[model samples]
Target: MDLIDRYIYAVTRRLPTEQRSDIEKELRGLIEDMLAASADLATKSASGPASDQTNATIRVLKDLGHPALLAARYRGSSQHLIGPEIYFLYTMVMKIVLLATGGGLLIAMIVSLITGAGGNPFTIILETLGSLISGLAAAFGWVTLVFAAIERFSPEKIKLDRDDIFDPLDLPEIPAKKDRIHPSDPIASMIFMLIAMVVASFVPRFVGIFWLDDPASNFIPLFNSAVFMMYLPFILATMAITLTREIGKLVSGRWTLGLALLSLGVEIPSLILTIVMMSNKDLFNDAIFTQIFAWLHQSDPFYFDLPMKILVGRIVIGLGVFGFVVEAVKTFVFWIKRAD
Candidate 1:
């Protein structure tokens, strides 16, 4: 293939299939201009009507830059989508959307089945499957259209002005924010943990339900199951907190106090768990102390004895107190300065 055709193919192939033909046409037009320039140059030169097709093409291509570089220019010199990242993000977003929809639908169906709606088993299953498929197809169609439209409308074709010209545009850059959840985060997490602990501890004793005509017998999955189910709330809360922390740093800017408060909402469970852990020793085996005594006794199990655990715990608690005092003093000083 000719140099122009090869260059066009290399670049337009990187674009969406729908856009490739139109892009190829534009690229060919550009090549034609370059070829014309070279031909005119040859005619005007003092070499006496000399013309070499290979030399002329090489000269034209060389002036246009490397094939890849020339192709990249069409994606807008200032802002453009890289070949790989475009497809990757598209797929990633599509996956998240699909998962969200599918999960919601599945949860709903399962809950409905568990609640015992009067319906034929086979018919219900078939209906559910058909509905799911239909919903997924409809969602896929809309989602695919949205992605395709975004790809089509990408501002990759805007001609960039040469650096020699005066420019006035200035973009504001938002700094990445840190997500340091306030004390509130720990509170919510503690609450979730406690709820999980309580439900795990007591809820099973009260759970009695009949699945079939058989006597209502055998409640609570297992002790391990109870523990896991109880902790589900805390696990979910922690994940939410972590997500907010990351997202606060990203799309929303920084981890502001507002986000910290939101994290606290989740941390409530954690605080409750911590408190419960501190007050209750019977809940734990001999090896496991209530959360408080455990923290107080925390030491290298292999390296330290009870004495060292107490010693280290006391020192750590002292340090925590000292830190609080220092912060309080600093705040007082700031207030004094403001008053003066």
Candidate 2:
């Protein structure tokens, strides 16, 4: 029975998502009917001994052929460039690539605007639109080409929809509800990562306070732009690593011990980078403190002095470490419970 369930899972998971439920029902009924027929035939024959249920099940499965072959039959025919075997993966890849492309281009536009490299707002808007269209087209074309080639030429292992050897025992276990990943989770994670990347890349240029009453000079940046630029690479790298982890989760569509470990691995580098950036005292703009004192029209109190800046940085570092630990513990605990 577990073998049958696994077999159904194996075959159905490879087919188009919309066709899976109906095909699964039909396949289950067919397998059951075949088993019943075999039982009746065995009874009529008065075989030397009762036929083994496992043997009968195996016989029926073998007679039906390999799961991949059966799945192909259910799919009917493939006239499209990408066959149904890998069509779902192809589409999913396309979606993720397009999203990444759009986000990267938007970040580039933000950087340009912040640095005054983009001349006029109207011109920048038009340029961004043109770039977005071209970037999306390129992403679509390249992703489609790769998946099409994989579907047409790659062996079963590479295509990920076929089995080298058809063994019901080797079929993957159906994931428990707690272990399953919802699409929204990965999508949201990716969106958050993109936003973080955009903000990190451009914050050095514009993160500050704007004065409402002062007409001459209205804004004071909070960070030393030069120093912030020096740390940009590490910040972007951290974001990229986390983004890759999210993509892995999306592709896997379930939590595993490996994925949990990978998340912790990614968190380490991210935490280290964040701590480094936060601890760098030279990165903050001293002028911001002066402006704040001027606005309050009072001498700097001890809590608002140079040591206060160091204390604030230490607090941020502590909070970051605590947050990382909480997330890591939660991920591993959930995965362990699900495994049980």
lDDT of each: 0.48, 0.75
Candidate 2 residue-wise lDDT, 241-264, digit = tens: 776677567656778787888888
Cα lDDT for residue 317, candidate 1: 51
TM-score of each: 0.33, 0.59
lDDT of 1 by residue, 102-195 (tens): 5545554553455343145565566557757865675466445544544444333111223444344633334333233343444344334333
Tell me how candidate 1 scores on lDDT.
0.48
What TM-score, to 2 decimals, does candidate 2 have? 0.59
Which 10 successive residues of model 2 have the least lDDT summed? 154-163
